[model samples]
Target: MTASSSGALPQPRRFLRLLNFRDSLWLLAPIATLYGIFALIPFALIVRFAFADGGTHFATVLESRILVRVATNTVVISLMTTVVALVLGYILAAGLWRAGPKMQRVMLAFVMLPFWTAVLIKNFAWAALLQDNGLANTILQGLGLTNGPVTLLHNRLAVIIGMVHYVLPYAVFPIYSAMQAIDRKVERAARSLGAGTPSVIWFVILPLTLPGVYSAALLVFVVSVGFFITPVILGSPADMMIANLVNYYVRELVDFNAGAALALMILGAVVPLIVLQQSMGRGGRHGAH
Candidate 1:
């Protein structure tokens, strides 16, 4: 057809024609631009720094004596935090699952109250409560449990406490989701078959909740490893985790290369765990059929 006779399609029609999945890559431009500017570029620079000087910084970090100690501390604290959070989280999730509507609302609000609070604020609050002569010590002294103010803050225990408080919500959500997926009829049938409360929980509820607990454990432990402020606020120098290694290398030693190297190492470790979690999720998360 002649252009004059047929006329060109209108601009909107042409634009709409280009909007299909294969041709619509431009839709991602804005977010990709922002990510490049904000995330990828900075990360690339970190990689560059880490790989500079024949990649000696990696060796420097590895050879450093404190690396072993800091790594151990990080692993130990994260594991402890995961275990404690798992236990408490299971209780909370179970309560949430079984609660009446009004009580569930209250409990859910209590569970989610931490998300709105800043990490800095929460750590500092824990620091205040755990400090010498703070409320915890006052209560201890008042109850004659201590002859004097006990040292609650500036320890590994304090770090764990702060971390648990921060990460409790993460622990709860996955477990709660798993708990909600449980078939209540299973429990009812167990009871009808003469299974008592203990038997029902042991054979039915506990078995089903295991997947969520496992998910929450990995998630909480992964999060716990990256803790920085909590250790600084509630713990002594001895309690430094892996993240503190970056700060130590960069700020204390004035070694950005080593800091970048340490950061890359951390990224390497954490990314795999995250990938495993996501892969597991794709396989099916906390299903209880």
Candidate 2:
């Protein structure tokens, strides 16, 4: 019995030594510490403030009519942004997938332009172009489309436009990745089976790319929900989103607790969507295998 116990202790020590060699926790320590300090600590504080006084801050937020409207606007605007971004992104991805090497580089450059530009700069540019008598209106008038300037700026439509532009690249990369993963032989097989171009895409390509589409939609929706500057710059007061509401609570109303509660509420809403997306991604991997 003594010998068996002594041997088992050495086995665990040897396993630990092997694990230390294979997986180095020290490499992750710096990033883990930074994340804990910046993200985890703030999140913990928000959660703590949210539940203070037996959750009275949440009760206050729930009772406000303005908050309800803000929530609705957040959902509607995010949905619109997600749908438009998905459609445009899919088209761009398809074009990228079909283009030759030269054209692919050009298209990829355009797709990445927005990523290189700061979000504030992009939003400001959109605001300029969408405003009354701006470039779009100027061109429309030049083409005899409208006699006078249209109310294009400071509205929900403008908000959606800016968001779609900002998020289009995100959608493009994922869908393009999925397209790249598809086997060319399968496409050729379909062609040999007398399938037309449209039929091939509809039956094979679209189905294979559904995972990417879903991923893009979720990413866009998640990003849209967290939009702070775009809506403020491009949208009117009526188009306030949840992030704006949190800002109002904290900055305007000077209610840190309520702001934390609303922020926590946003986190609560987004977490389930993230979990769902992760599960779908895992399912897609399994399907691919």
lDDT leader: 2
TM-score computed on alpha carbons, candidate 2: 0.91
Per-residue error for 222 in candidate 2, Å, reads 1.0
Positional deviation of residue 55's Cα in model 1 after best superposition, in angstroms: 2.1
lDDT of 1 by residue, 70-140 (tens): 99999999999999999999999999999999999999999999878999999889888888878999999
Q: Which candidate is the best by TM-score?
A: 2
Stretches > 4 Å off in candidate 2: 1-19
Clashes in predicted model 2: 0
**Candidate 1 Cα outliers beyond 4 Å, as residue runs:** 1-16, 22-30, 284-289
What TM-score goes with each of the models?
A: 0.90, 0.91
lDDT of prediction 2: 0.90
Residue 208, candidate 1: alpha-carbon lDDT: 78
